[model samples]
Target: MGVMNELINRQNVETLAQVLGEAAPGSSWGHVAGAAAELDGLSLRARTDRISTALLADIRLMPEPGFPTAARTFRTALGSAGFTGWIIWPVSETAVTLALETGAGPDPAGDFDDCLALLAELTPRLTGEFAIRRLLDRDLERSLRVIQGWTGHPDEHVRRLASEGTRPYLPWAVRVPGIVLAPEATIPLLDALYRDPSDYVRRSVANHLNDVARNAPALVVATAERWLAAPDGNTAPVVRHGLRTLIKNAHPGALLLLGFVPASLAVTGPRLDRKSVALPGELAFDFEISNTGAADARLAVDYVVHYMKANGTTSAKVFKIGALTLAAGETRSVTKRHAFRQMTTRVHHAGVHALELQINGIRHGHTEFQVQV
Candidate 1:
């Protein structure tokens, strides 16, 4: 795949200029065209912001130059041969900038509501999730009240945006502290959207619930419990995904909700193939578990890697293994290989690292190994 910065490159900026210039013939789009060279060395999000800033200058040249005028100009360009793809990211952002910079009228509420409508209209092309943060931070209640209404919208993209845009910990999006402070504010939207007909919308609801779990574990559990109580065929997976973080942390409620109850099991060694591993290497391990109880047991088996951080502290991350039902008096062995390679998301430290097995919220068989990076 191409790097993220390529999403908003010189070609995209030039295309945006042509579309916007055609939509409003009188306005000069040279400001946007000039921003192409400035995108070099910048990250994806930075390029988006730079293009939006350039578009703002050109938007001011339009007649009555404001958010309403800019929204109409942009709407006019939405056709078969109009601007689309990543270029629309900056266009939507420019709309947000103009709305926030210049109020619609004396009534701020009117401007707020209208800006939201514009975003909803633009979201079908490219997400307005990131740009919606500015409004959420400005007045979360106002923005949410509008977004809540979006849950029932016919379009799946709008429905997904209703949940994704308001996530407390939305990735690559601006932080909305109000959502974190009041985690319950977005729960109703999740409640309305968790059973959406579209898988795309349902996934966003699951992610939104997961984001809420970061701050309010109890609240997330409660919400998930409600979902489970009145579940459809797809509800289980959604709850599992939504509660993944809590499950990794061994939250009792999350464990129980997923039916991974504590069980008596005779566990054997998580024997490592090698005690020491070199850089860009793999470590093979195997573990055996027998259900010692009178009844069968459901297992949520996972492997934990306590990675040594730069500060000499270890951070634990859980990697999932498949779940299975263990019959009474039956033993099963599982063998897996873990690769310790260089990755942008994870940095390997040359020191002692630890591995352990976790089943149904219970940890077992701690093992230490040396990593040479």
Candidate 2:
């Protein structure tokens, strides 16, 4: 199992039951205890769902059990010191699930609003990001309208949840189609948050914009441009991260916004140290670039690897090689080493692979090498 999946193992399940058992005495926590036994083969998210299902079943055993009642029980644990860590993931999930299940409890609108508030409060425990997506999926505008206020929240965690939760492609969280369909909806929130004091919150804002850049490059560039016009000391990094996807795709506006404009350059071989590499080996290469034009060139140097896939096709992925400027009639040499190994994120396939250099938004040198299985 992946290390991340192990985060919600038997110990975490038992800890969750112990904490909840303390909050609600007399209720059978056997349902939650069984979650530990059921967790073996499940993925991280599946384990969360399994635990949440158990939590819901245990909560249902209480008299007059409903959204408000369950929320109160959760709140009791929230006040307890043990109500933190990975355990909160299932707790957050349970809160939202119960809220949706019992729509017209004591106060209908307030139930939904309370759930949003509960997530913001719960975020400091672990993260309410994943739970908030279901709320967003239920009512995008209402959720955004409520979350919009979170941008200025005093807690950095709450502020980050504001951006991270609304992200159209938030990793591991269910997609909120409304955010994808109406990409502009979250722009205001990003605008409010790009200059946030906390790096944690600003990073989430950058990722949110990066998600929007997938389909709306122009909007992202325009937003980045505006931020550049009135940039704070940290704005550049935020804009750069936000436009990373567009930058990788060689989007002109994104490059220009980051000062990596078109440039005239004399390029040399991305001379390979070896023409072939073995599995679990390393390949080294060096290259040189000279400013051929009379003007200084600001460059975003990158390298691309055309990796051979299991399907006998090559897929190219870009990797950064650091940025530099070449003055008129100046030249610079660069060397880099790359390792090929099996990883959970990427698998190595033995075949002919290609490497290319990218300067500014243009591709320069191409070299082919072989990988032996």
Top of the candidates by TM-score: 1
TM-score of each: 0.96, 0.96
Runs of candidate 1 exceeding 4 Å displacement: 102-107
* lDDT of each residue in 83-149, candidate 2, tens digit only: 7888789999998988877553878778898999999889998999999998899988888899999
Look at candidate 1 and tell me the lDDT of residue 126. 83
lDDT of 2 at 4: 78
**Poorest lDDT segment (10 consecutive residues) of candidate 2:** 100-109
* Displacement of the residue 284 alpha carbon in candidate 1, Å: 1.5
lDDT of 2 at 74: 82
The residue pairs in collision within model 1 are none
User: Which ranges in model 2 have alpha carbons more than 4 Å from their true place?
Assistant: 102-104
Alpha-carbon error at 120 in model 2, in Å?
Answer: 0.6
> On residues 1-373, what C-alpha lDDT tens digit does candidate 1 reach at each position?
2498898898878888888778877778988999987988888888888998888888777668777788788888886365777877888888777777755546556767888888888889888898899999988888888999999999998999999999999998989989989999999999999999999999999999999998999999999999989999899999999999888889999999888998989999799999999989999999999999999999888999889898999989999987879998989999999999989899999898999999998999999999999
Report the Cα lDDT for residue 240, model 2.
87
User: How well does candidate 1 score on lDDT at residue 60?
Assistant: 74
Give all candidates' CA lDDT scores: 0.88, 0.89
